[model samples]
Target chain A: MTQRPSDTQPQGEGNGSKVNRRGFLKTVAATAGVSCLPILQTDANAFSLDAFLQKHFYEMSKEELERVIERLENEYKKTYNKKEFRVGVDPPLAGVRFAYALNLAKCIGCRRCAKACVKENNQHRGSEERGDQIEYIRVLEMKKGSLDLEKSNHYYDHPVPDKDSYYMPVQCHHCNAAPCTKVCPVEATWQEADGIVVVDYNWCIGCRYCEAACPYWARRFNFSKPRIPDEEVNTNTHYLGNRPREKGVMEKCTFCIQRTRKGLNPACLEICPTGSRKFGNILDPQSEIRYIIENKRVFILKEELGTDPSFYYFFD
Target chain B: MGPALYFLVSAGLVFASGPGRGEVKTVERRSVLEDQHGYYPCSDCHADQETNPKPRFLQEEHDSPLEWEDEAGNTHLVEFGEKLAIGDLLGHGGQTGNRRRNLVKVGARLDVAQYMEEQGLSESDSVYVLTHGGANLWCLDCHNADDRDYLRKLNGEKLSFDDSEYLCGQCHGPIFIDWEHGVHGRTNGYWNRELDQKDVTRRLLCIQCHIPHAPRFRGVVPEAKPVPRLDPVSEPTAESHGHERHRGEYDRLGPHPWVETASTGHAEEPAHDGEKH
Candidate 1:
């Protein structure tokens, strides 16, 4: 990426030459150091000093937060050509801890839930030849009478609910002991009080450590800017959820933070035709998730690792 | 033209019809179904038919049938009528004792008329009839023949399109039971029905997804198909690994098949070969 002219200021010849010499040497040294590493550039070439020095989510003042939101809203409006686009930062609801469960027996492997997730979350739609887009949900088609993950196939194109097979859709477990957050060298990702693990796109350095840490492979790293058609852009966005991401950042499902915080169900939950997916406040004993956990023989993937995933899968 | 002159001209034209040509203006009666389903005039079938009060077949009478005998040695058969009312239709799950249960409500018909009047619409503008894969069945099989209303309950209750499960339950009792328990169809509301009623309106109806005539969930287009998993970075050396046939081998084993190979230290390649947009 080339440095923008806005990063420098005009100066007198004598002093400017001396400063230029020093900057040239500094650039040479920095370039040499970067060439040996695989670190990704987290920002676009346009260098805004204020954005570069923006504070973390917890450390931002009220005024600064407002300024950030306005800036992002303007940028998105210009980029998507949607003047009415809004970016919201709705805080998590009090006394709500979300948990998810999937009934394997009922899931027909239709993949409608996965399709709805992409649209609701504003995920990039990849082309037929190139599967560059990120999908938060993956419905794995497994042979019937088997609980093994290795035998599952996610790319099967045949009609679903095969006579001899079943399906299991998986996404971020949002585990209590989230290995993704722990492995983040920078505190760009963290679990909210409501148990949703969220990524701060601007703060993330795009190291991809979290991707490697997750056993379920839930985390998706943006190798390039995500492409969403202007008309297809989901205007409803959350700071920690479906807001458009930058060129390089790590993101994963946050249980539709933009919707759930407002007492709405996640897109996938609403799209399941078989009533297989269940989501609710785990703390509320009267919640459906609570009933499933208590009554159904529920289990989590990679349980031996003790990740304590909020997501559970049961055969019932 | 000036506004007054335009109004005068239009009003003069309206009054200019000569008394000698005193034919009254009449609307051209165009059947709304003509454009969509072709014209069908009632006269096509009713032409030259004599008005008879009794059904022809019934009036023929059964051979040697006992009749005109009452409890006091006199009996009679009630007369069958020629003109059929809307209530005469029977539907699925057998008969509701009263014929009125099968009848379309007069209010509903009037509502349609009112709507058409408001919108400047005309008669028989739509058809709800569907062909279920060329099955030879009449509309009266599952709906009232005259008004197309559905009857699944015997207590004279009519079901809306949203109440498809109950309507379908007429013949599919087991499937209806499964749907009631949230096992057969989609459920979107808050799992804890006892809690907030926020999700009540959002619950999806069965007809919203499945076509009632052909209740099958269609597969999504290829563009929306689930992508394959990213290929694992490493695999066990075919020579070094043994006992590959064991049922629970991968589960109980220490080293997983997808573990990073000792040679490659976290290779972070793009999952797909597609060029970045």
Candidate 2:
């Protein structure tokens, strides 16, 4: 094979054919400078299945997870020439803190937060009568007197208030005593060490038991194999978020744990033009979510139900 | 320079014959462009699509064509198809041929896995095996571009779809509709102004919607497709098919029953029950 400029070198486009497959492989190896493993397992140099089996987001040792992030950053640098792209293998902060506050006064029913949530959590896609793909947050418009969920249907043809109306967006509460997790037969759905509720798309049996068990009707089953045409499909997947799910398994709000744990604000918070939503580490007193819980009057839906949901609502 | 350069692009998708091989296989690739994105030759962007369609300077020279104006506006052409890449299209970046390539915009139909569940193909031995096997089917098969007449779409009356619209529409009609009508599609702008006119906003091309490096959504994480920035001025607009269709009311006046807060609270008030707007 002729000596050729590497793809990284940015030669004029036609000058690229000089490199062959073997040369390309060699270039990649030299660029990475990572040594090959001596054996499949047992050897100190080899990758062990143990690392894969126990690699939960919260359960990782600091050194181990940091190493993983380093490996990721290196790989990304090699691919896109971003010399310093670091990935988070574990949550930056900790404890089983529960905090979410929604200001009823601010929410306009634009559903931008819902769109952001669907993208952020990699929520499975579905269709609504609006003839648009939908998932997760369903912004319901309610009249002042009517508390009935059925009457407060979210479907809107025009913009804001038709008259004296208010919008309520609902999603998974990630309850501390989650009834859905308890009812899961295959153990596909479970609460994480950080108290975030999650459903493993690969493991879910799609039994819909979790859907039935939830009093809030939070869980939704995949009706069709999620046929997300490539663009809309979320690739930054967790076992719980974004990866395509099997049909029939129950799914609900994951509290945007994928984003929250990464020190990124929840998609809903970013997209809320009205700034109706707030998210932060519940354990930390400085977090807005915590401040709202302490300073303002807060209420959890069906607090008497004892599910101990992480979500809280505020009126003032 | 004429249509001779057309076949060169398709020829590149063909498997190469190394030193030991002789005859290049002659399976003409059908154009998926009209049925989908556009029947575009690869050389239009890539510098290497058809480097040598004919023998030039002792090597096989591809038939990539270049449009250059000579003295009296009479044009002279250069064809080097296989050797073409993205750079060659600097001035005439993409003026090769007439192949309307629209981004096949598809809205969330059934989550593929969800749809399979509705079909009862559980992860049992029989079902799982079929799924695994079915995944191997080449995307180009069902996404057949050969059918010239396959381009029929419900072009909603508003803004006529440009090349981007037609390309994605051929294989994905439903998504095309949503995109054109604002569900699957995207635009850029704030409270007001027309697009690409006074308050211009470029439409999210194919690349925008599907970011290759950071693909927002995809399954299995195969080599992700390149996505461009598709941040629209506003969300795709809703298709207003002259109603009296789904829920009657072509137009009317009353209290907007659509207002959730008003209707539900005052059940006694008939005016609140969507009888108004």
Candidate 3:
């Protein structure tokens, strides 16, 4: 095998001076910086990337976190070209209220909605590093001839609707009986009060228990730094939706909690062309979504598992 | 030369392929470049393009001759209390069956051109059929929609709205950008578990916020330009006031950076043409 050029090797034609002098210097400086630092450098008092993220998401008070929020706000505006932005720190959540619903009949195997969701949620479209499988929604195109529960499709080819086809969009159920939550050795993943399951990405260890524990292949682990471009990024990132995730953490959809809980509709709901999905407060009958669930023929996926999912699907 | 060439193209009669399998030998059918399938013929609506050679011929053949030239070299025909340039109808300026109190609207469009040519008159100045209206919209701009139907012209031809998005995209680049980003209009699914399956429908970017009837070119984006990063709305717009009824000024409202470029709850119109929910 041909040997690669050595950073310090002299190969200037017949002149034997090092051609890659600059590369050699950079490598040397990097080595020196790494060697000089202790294995665990104490920040005078004591703080680390993991330890700080371990704090409750809402632990930072207004006075303590004001500077941080402002900094992120400015960063977002500068990057997105938005002006006069209002970014609120999470005051607190009564509980992580998560809900989802899919319409089986109207989902016509058109994955235009899937593409929109991918863009909105910042799921790396290409192969993700081990811990980073970000696609929260998968459209299952079932054959019109076979409606078999066991034999339905999870794969879709281009130029859809071969006579008879139905689309079923899948995402994390945020199970009330969350298997992944049970197996977290580090207490990193927890169920919020409002029915949403959340993982403190910073607190997660590289343990794969959560991955194994879940029946619905929902959770994904990030093995490397996320590779989303700065421009395509949705800068109004919540912990769940648009933010660039870190290495070695598990992530999934948050129902666009960043937008939904604040009285805004989820991005997918906002852009559906054929009106095949629905959302609203389950508690409020007057809510458009509630009226549908109460009045329509509603059913959940994998009902036997008894996850008691907030999501429900229905037909007329 | 431009005018002369146009005049030649107008007068030169040629048979051409038209909508569907049939042959289209008229200028009217040939003018529309895109929507050949939906081409409405000239004589089908009015007389044949051959019948109207120019203002003089149109007047003599149709039994009327006039010109609508004024001191500024063009007559100010009025309609909707606005001056409209009818230069698209060149050389055929005259009094028409369309008029008010025997006087022209300051900027009339269709009628005066026909009337002036019928009168067989000329002005010291050349005609400026019309300029950009107060809305600053050129006649050829939004009117290029592929499905337009033209009534009468000697050339017997029509045009398309190919360059239209550029005109609309000018003020609404944000909407256009958002559109390109797959965020502006409806494409897929959204969940409001509260809504019925049929309730969620296509999202309308242009006709949604802007009333569809006039759909006057508004901001750069379609009416519903998504400011994703959450710049607070200082005050509610007429379109948004119903759902986002809290009428107060926002301190700062904007989208996040890195990309260019919301809710409803209320008794929406029972006949909302947009995608539901």
Candidate 4:
């Protein structure tokens, strides 16, 4: 570990110790007060100074990114005792903008999608210290006649699809005019070419600005170190999605970038029993999402805000 | 790739060892009792009986107990016992058994006149109607069934279980049209056809999701409510909705914390003081 610079310095080696030491101490105090480097350094991880100074995802050079990825992989192996954990930086797919449409009539509120998301994203399981598990998707049970966000009940434990109710699962909408990205002071988060808004976990300064800016309450802040069991950790993680996040960073859904970039379905879509959830490249006119958008009365959550969210919902 | 190639080579080696001698020498013949045989070339089983025998119902020795299904009473009930009298069998109103139960029995040959008289149905009206419950049409309506328990399609064409869609489409025209567009039933293949060829074979048939006898989807057990992130340090709330982990004061609906930071005069330093690991 690199020792943090302190106010004290050793006596000069070549004599005239008092004069030289006084000058050195004065200069150090002057720099410390103006720079705040000492205060920021204290916030850095004690184990590795290099990790603390690592650049954000976009700012890093190719070689630097590779170094970071290698370090992360090694760190995962040591922490989890699993040599097979792989962390890949998959580039965004070209000529493809992902979109999702969920049918309100077909969803039965089984929450199988939510369950699969927790497992796929490797979210923290509930512990004695943390009673609730972290789930990316929230299925809101709303009354049949209205679509009131405030009146919706996500904690409804009753036998679902309760004759008069309908379920709407909400997550990160990956808005085109994302307010979260605009509010991020450090440019730690940004929208990719494929319409996915991703976060550079390491670079996020725990500012929680993105959390406040998101209209759907999509972003989540890690107030404590995320504790995941060794067996439950999903090794097929991407640089932008489902990566092991540290305490104080913000994390939200990324449309399962690791799987989607490889032409695989998101875990939630694959697990849905009713086939209510639909996901596909929005660029392709023949895609199911496009068909639904054209044929069905598709609507976004807060259309008035003009966020241009990729996620859509329609009734039968 | 190497392992797959090796396995293919090994499989070829095993087959190349030659077929068993006995299997090759044996004569290939369809079984007499096979369902598709349907008493074909009848002499094998009925060699003694003359070609033109007395009417089926006139023969006393071939008499079988008629079983009535009490469709109105309880369709799920299964009752099998006692011979029904001719009068009782012909009586329409007093028949206590479900009409949908045993439309066609294994060994019993229904007398058309008696069935019509018992159910008060005329020759112009068919006994079997098609729906989710029992089809009004009997086994003989769609199948040429014999006493030996063999069945064949009425037109002598083979019926495919996989292509039952056409058979069901005979009556359900609108629903079948909806199914063709992947609207009604579960579709199990790639939704994006530009990437992968449209494989209709992988799509689920109407029968796969809905049983013909009972077309309703079975109720599934709801997954446990998401244990929201409760304040681990605080006491548990008795109210179900109250346990929601309070997202700090600066969430979606709340104002951005820049104002408070300016007021507190600690804008230079990020305020992450209370976070615990």
- Provide TM-scores for the models: 0.57, 0.40, 0.45, 0.62
> Of models 2 and 4, which has the larger TM-score?
4
lDDT for each residue of candidate 3 in B41-119, tens digit (9 for 90 to 100): 3234344323322211111222222222322355322121112234423434454432221123323334555555766
lDDT of 2 by residue, B1-277 (tens): 6566767754543322111111111112122232223324333554333333221111123344334342235554322112222222222235322111100001021243444455554332121111111222222222223332232233422212233346445555764553443223233221111111243322344423342112222212111111111221122212321111222331234445443343454434345556656
**DockQ, model 4, C-alpha based:** 0.15
Q: How many backbone clashes does candidate 2 have?
A: 88
Candidate 1 chain A, which ten residues in sequence have the lowest lDDT sum? A36-45
TM-score of chain B of 1: 0.31
| Model 4 agreement with the true structure over B189-265: per-residue lDDT tens digits | 34443233332224455554454433445457678666555444433232323323343322435755453353565
Error of 4 at A217 (Å): 1.5
What is the C-alpha lDDT profile of model 3 across A119-138, one tens digit per residue?
77766654412323356666
Per-residue C-alpha lDDT of model 1 across residues B189-217, encoded as one tens digit per residue: 44334233442523444554455543444
> How many residue pairs clash per model?
5, 88, 81, 12
The per-model lDDT (C-alpha) reads 0.63, 0.48, 0.49, 0.65
How many Å off is the CA of B89 in candidate 1? 29
The interface root-mean-square deviations, each candidate in sequence, come to 19.2, 22.4, 22.5, 11.9
Per-residue lDDT for A1-316 in model 1, tens only? Answer: 8878966765656754555767878998999898734334433335445567888987899899999888888778877875566678888665678888898977888888878888888887755444467888887777778878776766666666665778888899999999999999989999998899999988999999999999998998776578888888898899899988887889899899988776667899887766788877777654556667886788889999999999999865
| Candidate 1 Cα errors over 4 Å, as ranges | A1-45, A127-130, B1-184, B188-200, B205-223, B226-277
Sliding window of 10 residues with minimal summed lDDT for model 3 chain A: A89-98
| Candidate 4 ranges beyond 4 A from true positions | A1-46, B1-159, B166-202, B230-277
Candidate 1 local Cα displacement, residue B107, angstroms:
42
